[model samples]
Target: MMDGGRGQVNVALEVLADLNINIPVCGMVKDDKHKTRGLIYDNIEVPIKSGSQCMHLVTRIQDEVHRFAITYHRTLRDKRTLYSILEEIPKIGEKRRRELLKKFGSIENIKNATYEELLATPAMDGKAAQSIIEYFKQTSEA
Candidate 1:
């Protein structure tokens, strides 16, 4: 079962059909206020009782899927942002950026690290460590 209206459900059904998967596909169609109105199957609108166990289950599933999607996107965005910030530091490339993040866990930790601490990380040398220290110093000042 999917959480959407006719148009969304129809596309999913077509994709499944193309894959030769024969299974009953139903859509939890929502009304104008975004509440589930009925289940659409075989082009039929089957009303579900309000506050019923089935309705509760469908609502929970939809909420869970939305929450998971948001969390996943936020994680990806944070990683991209972190990498971009690291790239601004001279002498730091992809491999060194990865190693620093792996060792320090987060940008905040890397920023707080002492020159000796940054130098101790694998694949990091004096130049890279100094660049990181200087980059954070400049960003903090700005």
Candidate 2:
């Protein structure tokens, strides 16, 4: 969820940059303990300093993205779910899925992660890592 949050912040920032949504943009940051801090504005992070600003921007973004998600983004995540890492080979069943999740933790970690790190997991192999790369490519296309 934190990774997703970071991505959302980045997307909002990019939208502001590209479309010139000049509302003062801030990022909701999490501390090392994984606690919700405040926000970062213009590279200077202020913990919960601009929660209202961040909330307003996020709400606006959700409204806009919800409007467009089905039309554009769905086409991508939908197409790729079939070829996704854990779902790629039929041989990888429920047990393997649980094991993978237990080992790697989350999808974002598995995605940004290197093949070597993946292979280092107990019982995970090169073939699984390759499948992960294939899934990553699909998601990136989205």
Candidate 3:
């Protein structure tokens, strides 16, 4: 299933077909009034009656999926922002960032961690730990 306008739904279907995912795709789209219009299947718009059980189910599903997608995107954005700071430090790539996040849970915890504690994290070395320490110190000072 999908959620978007006609163009978006069509493109998604095409991409799914390209990936060899053989499944029927339907879109939960909204009308000009910002209301749940209905399911768009096989390039046809199937309008659902307002206040019907089917409408309630479709609206609930669409609302839930939208909320989930937004939350997921926000998390990725926050992680990117946090990891971008780490990227500036030498020897800190995707693997090291992941390791640090796994160990400390958040950038604030990593910042507050001691040099020795940083080194104790999996895949961390003395030099990387020192760099992290210095990065936080420099930022805090500035």
Candidate 4:
């Protein structure tokens, strides 16, 4: 995922959602165990329970998405230096913010995006998208 980042993960989620792919996404989320954990999407997290019957289901899914987005069984090891001005915003973090930038292409374009447009990106809820739009407008005026 985009240089082993969550933003790329969210992008994958959106692409799947748009394509109407109905599988749950599971991946290595760095928490206490340092083991394979569930991914976060749309502000909610779908976790993978280990050593359970659900584990098999989760593993099957993780394997499938991996084959689709990536080559074989490996994760994205490196990332290119692709970014926009919006990604520089504070409190945005690497996941949701970069997703917004990539989806909108630029701050100007994102400012042009309606609330529904902003919400199209994964993890961007109504409030966050509106706040981002407001920031874009404020910065444009200043």
Candidate 5:
């Protein structure tokens, strides 16, 4: 499943083809006011009624897909910010950064974690844990 108008659908199809993916793709398109108006399948328009069982299902799917995509994007953005912050602390490379995120879930959680908890994370040692704690402290103080 995909979202957007004709251009986006075309791009998605091209990208998928490059990746060797072959599957039916359908797009949920929105009108100018950002209302889901119809489904575009294989370049054919399936008009959706304003209020009907089929429309209800399409709306639900569109809403859920949009929410999921936004949440995923936000998570990636947070991870990038966290990774940049972690890079400032010595000895915290990609592996350590991933371990920290996996353990604490977020940068805020990592900042609030106890020294012992930080040390308990995979690939984390006492020095690395102390560096992370001190980094957050210095940032907070500034």
Candidate 6:
């Protein structure tokens, strides 16, 4: 059972079909008020009794799915934001950015690192290390 409505269910069905997996897929649909209303399978709506155990379970599942999706998206967004910051450094491309991240774990660590520490990172050169140091310095100043 999916936590979303027709759109999500259809997309999931299509993906499963592509993988040669045939299984019944149903969606726990919400009403206009954003409350779970019923299940939808093959465009048929099966109304769920409000305040019933079934309804409560569906609500729990939907809440958990939404929470998980939000967390995953936030993590991806943070990674992208960090990588873009690294991209701003003149001599830091994908490889050097990756190396810096691997060595320091976070941008805060990289920014706090000394020039020698940055240069010691694998795939990092003196120019790239200097670029990172200068970039962080400028950003901090602004």
Kindly list the per-residue Cα lDDT of model 4 for residues 10-104, writing each as its tens digit.
77778899999976553345466555566555545567677777657656766787677776323333222234455555445578867876787
Worst 10 residues of 5 by lDDT: 1-10
> Model-by-model lDDT, in order?
0.92, 0.64, 0.88, 0.64, 0.88, 0.91
* Candidate number with the higher TM-score (2 or 6): 6
Give candidate 5 misplaced runs (Cα > 4 Å): 14-21, 103-130, 133-142
Name the candidate that leads on TM-score: 6
Worst 10 residues of 6 by lDDT: 57-66
- Expressed as tens digits, the lDDT of each residue in 50-71 for candidate 6 is 9999988888888898899999
Candidate order by decreasing lDDT? 1, 6, 3, 5, 4, 2
lDDT of 5 by residue, 8-121 (tens): 888899999999999888887889998888888898888889898988998888889889999999988987887898899887989999999898888889899999999999
TM-score of 3: 0.74
Candidate 3, residues 1-142, lDDT tens digits: the string is 7777678889997898899998888887788897877888888889899999999898788889989999999999998898888889887888899999999999999999998899999999999999998888999999
Ranking by TM-score: 6, 1, 3, 5, 4, 2
Each model's TM-score, in the order given?
A: 0.79, 0.36, 0.74, 0.36, 0.65, 0.82
Instruction: Give me candidate 4's TM-score against the actual structure.
Output: 0.36
Question: What residue pairs are clashing in model 3?
Answer: none
Give the Cα RMSD of candidate 3. 2.9
Show the colliding residue pairs in model 2: 38-47, 38-48
lDDT tens digits by residue: candidate 1, 67-129 = 999999999999999999999999999999999999999999999999999999999999999
Winner of 2 and 5 under lDDT: 5
Steric clashes per prediction: 0, 2, 0, 0, 0, 0
Model 3 poorest 10 in a row by lDDT: 1-10
Model 5 alpha-carbon miss at residue 72, Å:
0.9
lDDT (10s digit) by residue, model 2, range 18-62: 986767555557668754455566666555443577556655665
Candidate scoring better on lDDT of 5 and 6? 6
